[model samples]
Target chain A: MAVAAVRRLAATAPVPVFVARGGGTGLLPVELAFDARLRLVVSPRHATVLVAAGRFPGPLGVAVDRVHDQLPAPRGTLWWTADVDGDRPAALRDASVVTDADPVGSVVALHRDLCLGRIRSDAAVLADDPPNRFEGRGDHGQGGEGMMGGVPWGRPMAMTGDDRDGLALDRLPVVLGPFLPGFPNGLRVHAVLQGDVVQEAKLEVLDLGSGPRLDRLDPAAGGAQHDLRWLAEALRLAGLGALAVRAARLARAAPAPASRAALARLVRRSGLPAAWSGVGVIDGEDARARLVRRLDPSAPEGRSPGPSLERVAEVLVGQDWSDAVVTICSFDLPTDRAEAVIEAQA
Target chain B: MTAQAEVWAAPLLTAGVLAAGAYVVAVLDAAVAAAVSGAGIGRSVLAGPLRRAALLVVQQPSATERPDAASWALAPALYAGLAAAGLAVIPWSASFSVADVEAGIVLWGTVESLAIVAIFLHGWSANTHQSLLAAYRFLAAGLSYLLLSMFVLIAAAIPAESLQLSRIVESQHGLWNVVRQPLGLPLFAVVALGSSTWGPLNLADGDDLSGGTTADVSGRPRLVWSGARAAMLTSFSAMAATVFLGGWQGPVLPGPAWVVLKTLVVLAALVASGHLFARVRTERFVTVCWLVLLPLAFLDLVIAGVEAL
Candidate 1:
C-alpha cells in the first residue's frame, strides 16, 4: 500500500526532464521555461525523462546516447523533433516521439506512465563497462613512474604546474560541455586547471553538418526577442533561475515598455549587475556592461558580432571557472557564422 | 515526568521538530522561487517539495564508473547526522532538550566544522573532475567563514559567561545579542549561510559546474542530499535564534512556540536571500569573507566584550 502511494505521489510531480539540445531548438527552452508541469534539470542524473530535442545529426546523436545512459533507472526518453517522420536517431528508434510545438504535455504523460508502471523503463544504450582497463605501471602502482603521474584507467592524473601564485600545484585538465549546463548548447571548452582557476583554455566547436542552425526554427527571433532569450540564458548561468524564467516569459510575449522597465529594476535590485561587474572583460567591455546594455531599451537593436572562438579562448585563460562560464555566455556569437568559420578552416 | 518518559520523549520531540523544520525550509524555498519568478504563490508551491521527494523515492540512483560508493552514500547520512547533532543542543523549553551539555555552543561549533568534511566527501567520492573541483573550491573558501562563526559565537558567549546555548538564551533576557552587539546577527548569518553552503556561499553545488558537487548524484541519494542541506539550514536558523534572538523567550506565547516562530523567521530570511541574490564568484566571495566580513566579526566580538566589562 505504501508503494502504491509513493507511485501516485510521484506521478503528481512535475516531470524532471534533461534536454539534450540539438541545433534549431531555440523555441524549446522558451516553452519549457514557463511550463509549470515540466522542470528542466541541469544534469541527466537529476532527470527522470531524457528529452532528445531538435536535430542530432551524425556524431551528436552518439553524444545524446551517452547522456541517455547517464539517467538513473525508472527512466524514459522522448524524441521531440521537427522532422519526426524523416529519420530518428538509433537511440530513439522505439522511443516515444513528439512533433508538437510544446512537448510539456507529452513529457508529463511519459513521466506519469513510467511512475504507474504502464510503460517499461528504457534499457541502457551503451554497454555497462569501464571505458578503459584498470592497470598501473609504477613502482607502487599509483599510476606514475615515481609517485605522482600516470593514467590509471585511461584518465590522466593531475600533474604539477606553476600556478598564478608562483607555487607548484597539481593541474588537472577538463573538457566542459557541448551539452554542459550554463553553456550554449554546442559550445565546449578544453581547459587545464590548477585548483578552480583556469590555467589554459581553448574552445572546441562541434561539427554541425548534420543539423540546421539554432535560430533556423524561428526567423522572427531577432532584436528584442533575441536579446531576451540571451538574457534568460545568461541569468540561468548566473544561478538566478527565477529571474531567467521571468526573462523567458517576457521573451515569449510581445514586449511592453512597462514590463521591460520593471524587469530591469528587478535585475538591478537582485545585485546581478554588482556581482557581474568587472567579470569576463573582452575587448573593453565587461559582462556587467553587456548585460546592462542588453536591458537598455534605446541602446541598440542588433548586437555587434562577437569575437572568434579562438580570441574568446585567449580571454578565458587565468579566469576562475565560474567567471569563465559567465564570460562565455556574455558574448553574442551567431552560431551559424561560427560554424561557417570552422567549416572554412577545415 | 519519569526518567523513562524523558528518555523517549526528548528524542521524539527533537526529531519531530527537525523534520518539521526541514519540510518548512523546502516549502519556503519553493514559495520564494515562485514569488521571485512572478509565478505567484499557489497551493502547488507547498506541494512541490513533497511530490519531488516522492519522485526521488520511486526513481533509481545512477552509479559512476568507479566511485567510492560507500562514501557516496555515507556523505548525505553524515551531513544529516551533523544537522541533527546541531539541533539536539537547542532546548525547546526550559526543561526540554536532547542534550543540553555545558559546552553546547562548542558542540554546535564542531558540527559546523565537520560539515566541511561531509560536503567534501560528497563531492570527492563521485570520482568526477567537476565534483572534485567543487570540493577543492569549498575547502579554500570554508576556512574563512568558519573563523567568522567562531568569533561570532564567542562574542555571544561573553555576556553569558557560559558556553552553554541555554545559558546564552537566558542571558539574552536583558537585551538580545542582536541589539547588544548589533553586528552579531548579520555576521553570524554569513556563518550560517557559509556552513550550510546556501545563497551566495553555494560554491560546492552551484550551477556553473552543472550542479557542482551534486552533478552526478540523483534519485534517493539526491533526495537525502537535498534534505540534509535544508536540515542544515534549519539547524543554523535554530542556533541563530538560540544564540542571538533569545531562543524560546517571548511574552504571552509559550516558550517552545516562541522558539518555533523565531526559527521560521530566520529560515524564511535565509531562503529568500537564496532566491534574491545572484551567486557570487568563488574567488571574490572568499576575498570578501576574509578581508571584509572577518573584520566585522572581530568588531562584533569586541562590542560584546565591552558590554560584558
Candidate 2:
C-alpha cells in the first residue's frame, strides 16, 4: 500500500521543468553524466516532457562552483517565437497578475498573512533569520543612496554539518535554502544509467532553493548572470508558474569534467564497468548525479536490463500501463540523447 | 500631451513622497534589525566573510546584513533609474518638457530598457546563487513585460494616431479612448507593475526561491537604488494610470490634480495588493496571473476590438 501510495504520488506529483543551457558551443551530455557531485530534482508539471532540475544546494558551494566555471561559456542562445513560447508581450499590459495562495482573503487578511502566515509558530525564537532586505527600502537616511561606494563584504562562513547543528538552527523551522554558491537553480537532467540498465527512478528535490520559492523555471543550479537573465523573463510572466515538472519512473537522470576526472570516466577510464550500486531510490544529491550520462544512440539502451533490474521485475512484467502507476523520476538530462530516446520510444 | 501631462505636481510629489517614504522605512527597518538583533551574524558582512556566507545558506535572505538589504533594494533602484529617464519625457503644460520627441513612447521604452541591464549587473555583483536566481527571474519577467507594455501603447495609439504624447492626447479630446478601450487601463496597469517588479508580482525578489536578487548588497548604493527604483516604479505606474485612465479624465477637478489623484489611487491599490500577497510563492503568483488576470485583460481587449469595429 505504501508502495502504491508512493507510486501514485510519483505518477501524479509535480515534476519541475528545466531548460538545458543550450548554445552553439553546445553542452556535452557525457561530461554531465560523470559529475558525481551534482544531483537533480525533476519537474513533473510542464507542457513538455522536460525536467526542470536543480542541483544540491549544499555546503561545498565554493569548490563545486569552481569546477563548473572551468568551462568556456556558451554564446548565441535560442529564442522562443510566438506560440512556440506563450503569449505576445502586449497581452500583458493593464492587468497586474495575482494568484490564489490561500483559498481567498480580504486585503486585511492578506496583510496579516504577509506578516504572520507560513511562519513557524515559534518564529520569534527561531534564530532570527533576519528580515528580508526591503530594497534598501530601509530608512538609511540621506547617505543611503550612495553608489560605487565600496559596499562592504561579510565574512566567509563554514557550512559544516556539526557547526550548523551547534547554531540555534533548532529555533527556526526548516525552509528551502539557497543553492550552494556554485550550483544553478534550473538545470536540465540529461540521462540516468547504471551500468547498461535504464531503471526509471527519479530524484525529487534538487532545488537550488526549496520548493516554496520556485515559480519560473530556471537553469538548475544557476549563478549571478543566470539569475539576472532569468528574472528578466520572470518579470514578463504573470503567474509565478514555477519551472514545470516533466515526467521522469519508466519513468526512468550536471556540469563538467573537472581537475578530478568525471566519475563516469573514473570507472570508464579505469577500463572497468563502473562499480554498480544496485539502484533502489537512494538519497543524496551527488550520489545520484554520479552516472547521469549523455546517451550515445551509438551506445544503445540496456537491452539486457540487468540483474538488479529484476528487483522491479514483478512491477515491470506484463502489467498493463493502464493499471500501472507510472512513477516519474527527475534528473539531469543531455538534450540530444534524451530527445533521441523519446523519439525512439515514441 | 498636455492632456496626459498637464505636467501635474501630484505625480512628481506623490512619487517623491512614495519613494522617500519607502526609503525611510527601509533605513529604519535596517537600524531596528541591527539594534534588536545585536552583533552576531547580522551586523555587516564586513565582520567576516564566512559569517556572511553562512547566513546565505538559508534560502530566505533578510536584512541582517546591510549588504543583503542593500541588494534587496536593487529592483526598485532600477525602477528609479527608469523613472528618472521616463519622467524627463513627461510634458509639463506643453510649453516645457524634458525630451519631447516625435517618438516619446519609444523614447521612454528605450530608457526603461536600461534598467534591465542594471538589474542583470546587480545580480552578478551580488555573487550569491539566490541573487543570481533572482536575476534570471528578472530577465524572464522583463522580456514579457516589455513586449506587452509596448503592445498596450500600440492599442492606445489607435485613437491618438501619433506616437507623440501631445498628438496622442490631442486626438483624444472629443471622447477619451479610455471609454472606448477600457481594457487597456487595467491591462497596462498589470504590465506596469510587472515591469516595475513591485509587490504582488515580486517573485524574482522572493527570499525563499531565489534569495532576493542582490542579497549581499549594502551601503549608500542600496539607498539610491532602493529609493530610485520605488520612485520610478510608482511614477511609471502613475504615468500609465494617468494615460490609460484618461490622463486627468475625471469630472470637476483640474486635469493635473485629477490625474494625480487617479494615479495615486491606482498606485496605492497596486502597492497594497503587493503587500497583501507578497508572501505567496512564485508559482502561486504566476498561476494567479496566468489563470486570472491574463484572461481578464484579453477579454477587455476583445471588447475594445469589438467597440472599435
Candidate 3:
C-alpha cells in the first residue's frame, strides 16, 4: 500500500516518465526518488526559459507565494515546478531562454572543408532575439490556461526525447581532442627590405570570384592602428609576447624571417576575398551557366553549363574557358541559376 | 708393455682415475645445480604459467589412484644397475674395470639398455600419476633413440671389429673412430638424452608435476636416492661424451682434464634442462623421438656403418 502511494504521488507530475530501479531493491524509494528528482528535472526547456531570464532556483516560499498571488491575475501560461518535501533532494529542472528566430537561408557548414572555406563569394549575416511565450500561467498541472515554459513561436533545444528505441543514447563516442579548421585561408603580400625587415605590410582579403577585396595593415611595431589585439592573444596563447614585440621591432628595418614565415603561412591560408565580378546572360534555358561562361571563359561554352552558371546568360562575355572560376563565381549567379549551379557544380 | 705402449698407457690410466673422480664430483655439482634451478623455478611461479599449472596438476606428484611404491624405485634401480654394468666393461687403462669381457662392444650395448630402466625409475619412482606418466614417456622415447645410439658403437667397432673399447681406441692408433664415423657423435647425443631421465624426457621430477613426484619424500632417503639417481644419469652422459665426443682429445689441456670437462658439460646441460624446461606430454615426447629423431639416428648409423666399410 505504501509503495502504491509513492508511485501515485509520482504520477501526479506534469511530465510522463517511466523508470525502473533495478538495483535489487523494493519499489518504495524508487518511486519517492523519482518524485524528488523530477521536481528538479522539470523539463529543461522550461528551465532554459527561466535561466535565460536569469530567474531560476527562486526561493520556494517566495515563488510559491508569488504564484498563488499571481494566479488571480490573468496571464499567459507560465509554470514553476518545485519540490517542498524536506526529506528528499532533487536534480534541478533544466531551464533555457530561447530568444531569437532562426533566419532562413542556405546553411553553409563553414570550414567544413579546406576548399569549402575557400568559397568566399557570398557572405550572409543574421540577427535574432528571444521568443516570447503566449498564454502564460504559473501552474501547468493545475490546468492553468496555456503552454508553459515553451517558446510560443520558436523551438527550444531538446534535453531528452522519446527515443524511438526507448533507450537513453549514452553510448556516444568520446571526442579525445579539439580540432582547428582553416584559420588562415587565403593570400596576402607583405613588402620587406634587404635584411628582411618589413617597412610596410598590407593584408589583402578578396572574394574568390569578384573584386572589392579587403585590405588590412600588419604594422611591424605597435602603433595606434596596429591590429595586435589578435596577435597579442595569439602571443599570449603561444607564450611569446616578448618575442612578438622583438620580432615586430625587428620587422621595421628587416622583418625577422621567423615572423615572416609564420605570417606568410597564416596569410596564405587566411580566408580573404580575392576578387569579385558579376557576368552573365539575362535569359536562357541555362541562364546561370551562360553567365558562368562570361565570368570564367575557361568553363567553355561548347558544353552544357551547370545551373548556377547557366542563370546569367544575357551578358555572356566571350566564354570563360579558363575554368579558373572560383566557387563564389558560381554562387554569385542569380538566385534561380545559383541553385542549379550548386547542384551541378560539384 | 712396449715403451711406445707405455707412452699411451700412462696417460690413459691417469685419465681414467680423473674421469671417474669428476664423474662423482659432477654428480654433486648437478645436485647443487638442480637445487639452484628449483629455486629459480620457484621464483618464477607467479611470473610464469608452469608452476601454477603443474601445481594444479598434482600435489607431491598426486593422483586419485596411486601407483605402488615399488614402481617408483624400479627406474632408479635400473639406472644404477645398468650404469654399473656398463662400468664393468671399461677396462680402466690396463686393468681396473670389473670385467674386460671379449664382447665389450655388445657388453657396453647391453648395459646401455639399463638406462632405459633407470629412466623408467625416474618417472615411476615419483609414485605420482604425473611421474608415472613421465616414466611411461621416458620408456617410449628411450626405445626409439636406443637403437640409433647402438649403431654409433657398431660404427666405431667396424675398423677393429672388436667389441672392446680398448680395441676400438687401438684401431684408431692413427685416427679416431669419429674421423671415420662422424654421425656417431650426434646419434650418441640423441640416445644419451632420451635415456638420461634428467633430460627433457624423464622430467622425472614431473618437470610438469610441481613439487615433483618425490616432492613429498624428503630427509635422508630422498637425498640418498635422488643423489644416486643424479649420479647415474651424469655417469651415462659422461660415458657417451667420452666415447663419442672424442673423450680426451684436445691440445694443451691434459687428456684427463679434457675428458672431465666434456663430461661435466654434457651433464650440466642435462640437469639444467631437467630443472628449467617444462615436461612434454608423454605421447608427444615419444612421437617426436620415434618419428623424427629415431629415423635420423638409424639413418646416421647406416651411413656411419657404410662409411666405416
| Candidate number of the best DockQ | 1
TM-score, ranked from best to worst: 1, 2, 3
Q: Write the per-residue lDDT of candidate 3 for residues A293-337, one digit (tens) a residue.
A: 322212223223333322222222222211112221232222112
Residues A155-203, candidate 1, lDDT per residue (tens digit)? 6678897898899999887777778765665677889988778999989
- Mark the regions of model 3 whose C-alpha exceeds 4 Å error after superposition: A1-346, B1-75, B94-98, B121-127, B211-216, B248-258, B269-281
Per-candidate TM vs. native?
A: 0.94, 0.40, 0.37
**Considering only N, C-alpha and C atoms within 3 Å, which residue pairs clash in candidate 1?**
A24-A214, A144-A149
Interface RMSD of 1: 1.2
Q: Which tens-of-lDDT digit does each residue in B1-309 have in candidate 2?
A: 776665575456545655553443333333332332121224332332222122122113222333444444555555565776676555443344455578888876786677677766666555554455566656656655555556566666656666776566556666765676766766676666665566545544542332344344332343455455556565675557445665644567766665456656666666544422323233334555566656665666565455567
Candidate 1: where is the Cα deviation over 4 Å? A27-30, A85-87, A130-154, A210-221, A336-346
Model 1 chain A poorest 10 in a row by lDDT: A212-221
Q: List the DockQ of the predictions in order.
A: 0.73, 0.01, 0.01
User: In model 2 chain A, where is the ten-residue run with the lowest total lDDT?
Assistant: A243-252
In Å, residue A307's CA in model 3 sits off its true spot by 62
Clash numbers, per candidate:
2, 135, 82
